[model samples]
Structures are given as C-alpha cells and as structure tokens.
Target: MKCITRSLSCLILATVASVAVACSGADGADGAMGLPGADGEAGVKGDPGAAGENGDKGDPGTAAATEGTLTGTVTDAVLKDPLADVTVTVKDSGGATLGTPVKTGADGKFSVKAPVGTVVLKLTKTYYTDSADIMVGVIAGTTVSIAATMSEAATGAPTVTLAWTGDDFGYGKTATLTATASSPTGSTLTYAWANNTATKIGSVAAGTDPKTATATLPTLADATKLRTEGGVETQYVSAYKLPDRLEVLSIVPDTRGAVSVGVTVTDGRGQKATASASLNAASIQTGLRNVALGQRVYLNSGHDGTNAWTLTTKPAGSTATGRGGICSPPPRGGEYVRGGRESRRDSRGRSSAT
Candidate 1:
C-alpha cells in the first residue's frame, strides 16, 4: 500500500511542476483577427455646462473734435480806443449766422468758436456807424486773432453834388466836369475826381474854380448795332448809376457799356461824401448821338464808300473787275469788271471785293 501511495504523490508533483514551467515561459505570437462582437448599449446624455460670468466694465473713451476758436477786439476807429457795449454778429462767408452773437467786454476783447472756414464779424452799437464786414479765416485746432475799428456816426457829413456841364460829348473829346460842395459846419472842403467809366483818362486840368475841372474824354470805338429791324436799331452802350458808397467803377467800356464820372469831397474833420454822374458818349465818326423820342435821323451804313463795298459771290478761279461808286476805288490787275462791280483775284486764285 505504501509503494502505491508514493507513486500517486510523485505523479501529482510532476503535474504541478509541468504547470509551473508553462506559466513562466516566454509569450507566444498573436493569433489572426477575430470576428467583430455585437454593439453595446448607448450611454446617457450629459447635462449642459453653465455660461461664464460677464466681464468687468471698461473706462470711458474720449472723442476727438473738429472745432476751432476765434478771438478779436473792437476799437473806435477815430478815438483809437476800445469800444464797449458793442454787439458782434458772426456770419459765414455766405452771410449766414454762425452762432449766438457775442458782445465786446469793457476791454473791447471778444472770443468765440466757429466752424473751420471764413467767418465775417459785423459789429453794431448805439451812436456809432455800422462796421464793415470783417472777414477772417479759421483753422482747425488753432486760434485766429483780429483787431477791428469802428467809425463814429457823423453829425453832418459834407454833402457833395457832381455834374457834367454837357451830357453830349463826342468820343475822344474834352468835357468840363463840375462839383459843388456845401458843409453845414462850414468846414473847408477838398475835391478828388476820377473817371470811373473809362479804362484810361486824358489830361485832367483844374478849372478857374476849385470845384471845376476839365478832362479830355477817353476815345472809344463806335457803338455797335446788334441788329436793325423795323427802323429800330439796337445799340450796345455803357451806363452806370451812383451808389451810396464811393465804389470805384473800373471795367472795360465795351463790356460794362456806359460812361460815368465820380467825385469825392472831404471836410476838415475827415468826413467824406461822394457823388457820381453819367456822361453821354456819342460817336463822332459815325455821326451818332442820343436824340429825343421820334427824332428824324439818317442811318450810317459804316461804309466809307472807298473800302466798304463787298461782292457777295463770284466765280471761283476767275478774275473780275469793275469801277466802284464814288467811294469804291478801281480794281487791281487780274480782275474782272462789269457795271461798276469789280472782282479781284488773290495769290491763291481766290477773289474778294470791298
């Protein structure tokens, strides 16, 4: 029995030893891919996350501006002192108000803001003459400085009257111009004359009286007749009217169309007055003058009879000639003439008549 038990134990030990050796051996190579398994159950959906908190508030930002500043002073022109209690009206170049009107301080200084461009300041005060339009340019981000002067109201400014001795004056002729002055204050008066209509004037000499002067009229071309219809001719001429201010009238006679004379008189207290008058300019060469209503007159054809006749038509490349009337001269060589009608051929074989 003992022998049999020993054999059984030996067998068991051998089996155990074999199992341990197999477990401690190196790993074997991987086998071929296996068939895919069935899909498993789906997972549950997750809850949404919470939104982040709002950020902190930022600091305020500054805005850029496109405005500029203007400063100026108002002064009494004659007294050379600052003017107070004067109301200033600011206007754009087009005469539109810019802002609320500003007034001058006791020191005569003023300051205000305006859009970038030209601005005009008009000042008004009691007992003072209205100031002329003061213009100044304003720039962005900069200041413009100005000093203005205002004239005082005149109690009795010198009054002057101007007149031409004769309205009918021929072109390039001399005429007498007279000016009368009267000062309520008995202030002495001085005269300054100007030919406002003509581009250039002739010799101006003082006449016997201080207010009288003689001026050689400027020569002008004959008045142009635009058209003559039904015995009424339309002529181009110049004419001008007087103005409150002594505006210097300077323009071409042919363009503006009339002759006018101006005179300015000043008194002892530096007060000035002005007067203007129109002078009728007649055409001497054409024998043309202004006349009353329904006046009988002959029309000048502007032909001197010598070089004024023209041939309306003629045969090309042909020469012709003829004796002209008392004014038309004889035709040149290489010309054809027939019954006082003449045709002259030029170097280019063209013919023209006059």
Candidate 2:
C-alpha cells in the first residue's frame, strides 16, 4: 500500500507542472489584448503640438474693371436761355447714332458715359430751325460736356422790294444807284442787275433800310449787242440827256395819245417836275427829219459805241420806207410826216400841221 501511495503522489506532481505551463501559454495569448488597451488610449487624443507658421500669401485676385461719363447743356441762340427736354444724341464721325437719346434737364444740362473713343454730339428740337453737331472724345471715368445753341424757326417768306434813285442812264457814265428796299420783317437784301448776262452784285444787312450800289453804264463795246448788222437798229436810246437836263421816255404810249415820258428838267442840284405830254408821232417824225438834215446829236460818248449809231439813207429802189427802210436815220424834230412828198406839201401848205 505504501508503494502505491508514493506512485500516486508523483503522478499528481506531474499533473500540476503541466497545468502551470498551460497557464503560462494562456497569459501569453492575453498579452495581445494588453497591446489593444494601450492603442485605445493612444487613439483617445493626440498630444497638443506647436502652431504652424502662416501660409504663403495667396496669389492676387483678378483686378476689378474701371468705368466713365458724358455731360452737356443746351441753350437758345438769341436769348441764351436754357432749353429743356431737348433731345441730345451721341454719334460717331460716320453719322451713326450711338447709345440712347438723353433729354436735357430743367437747367439745360446733359451728360452721358461711354467707352473711350471719338464721338459726335447732336442737339435737336422741333421748335428749333435745325440741329447742331459737336465732336467729343469719350474716356473711361470721364464726363463729356457738349453745349449747343438753337435758332428759332422762320415764320413765313420774307418780302423784298427794290427801288432805284435814277432810272435813266447815259452810256459809259457811272451813277450812284440808291436802292431803297422795304420789308415787313427785316430782310436780307440782294442786289442784281439783269442783262444778257445776269449778275448778282452783293447782299446787304438784314433791315428795312435801303441799300445803295453804284454801277457805271457800260461803253458801247461793253453794251449788249442785239442786232445782226446789215444796217439794222443796233440799240435804242431809252435814256437821253438834253442840253440842261436828263429824261427817260417810256417805251409805251400814254392816255394823252403821246409817249409817256419823264423829264428831269432842272439844272444840277435842282428839283423840277413836268406833267406835259411827250413827243407825238408827228413831232417824232419831224424831229427825225431834222436829224436826217445832218444836225449834230451829242450823246454820252463814253461808251465804246457798242451802243452807238449813225443814220444812213435807204438803198435806191428799195420798197423800204419807214417800216421797210434797210437803213434809216433816227426820228428827229418831234414831228410825224406821212407819205414823204405829200406829207411835206401838206405841212408847208398849212400854217399849223396839227
């Protein structure tokens, strides 16, 4: 029995040692779990660290855009009063209207903003005669001022009357021609003298006062030629100067069965008027006959004779008489004698031909 007891004790001791080794292996397995606990604390929070330095300055942002303006005024021409509600337009030199129309303010001021370039400005109104144009340069952030003056529209057609100081003129003589003109409203008077060549001398100031101009009677060389030679009547002496006076005989007949005539019968610087009848046909014929008798007739000789004349007898055997004469002298002596010899005999037979 003692031997059996001792064997049992030895078996127990071996069992215990084996158990202790197993327990050690179990603890080794639990060591990985202890590492998980340490990791938990480490994840709980990181240690606080030093602050970082400021980051490099960011790149500059894109630059902002810039901007501009145009400004101006409108006024009346004569009164210089501010004009409101006038349409102001901007344009280019090419005449194209640009942007929008701006109406003037109560103070007649206007302004506009545009890009940098050359621009044309125009101001217009219905009551104004016409529009006006202005040139300007548009720049960024700049205000351009364009001023304009408007003129009043014309109401009606202006009347113009012309009168001369003297109607009768001598060849190659210069006369101070005083032209008196009148108009209801002030008129811009223009002077013109009509001939074969129409010529405009000049224009005078706008007013009711008369305007004067001086023109010289052209020389014969300067006179307008009307006839084609062949002993034709080259020119008619419409104005004449007597020994002591000047006269303008009308080309038409008067109510007194005589030619209407105007005779300035006074001497130099004197005033005179006459209402007597002009030369009758018979008197004209008589005067023509006397002139044919070779009486010397003095005329303004300054003309180059472009308007001069000399009388010549009719060609022999020519049926031409008064109306048919190829070439005939001007009527003289203020008498009209018909039927050559018969009229002459009648004049000599009667004491008074009238």
Query: Global lDDT of each model?
Result: 0.59, 0.43
Best candidate per lDDT, number?
1
TM-score of candidate 2 to 2 decimals: 0.28
What is the Cα root-mean-square deviation between model 2 and the actual structure?
17.8
Best by TM-score: 1
- For residues 297-316, write the lDDT of model 2, one tens digit per residue: 22222221222233234334
Position 313, candidate 1: lDDT: 36
lDDT value, residue 284 of candidate 1: 19
lDDT value, residue 105 of candidate 1: 97
Task: Write the residue-wise lDDT of candidate 1 on 117-173 in tens digits.
Answer: 778888898756898898888788899888888875785478888766654454456
Give the C-alpha miss distance for residue 183 in model 2, angstroms. 19
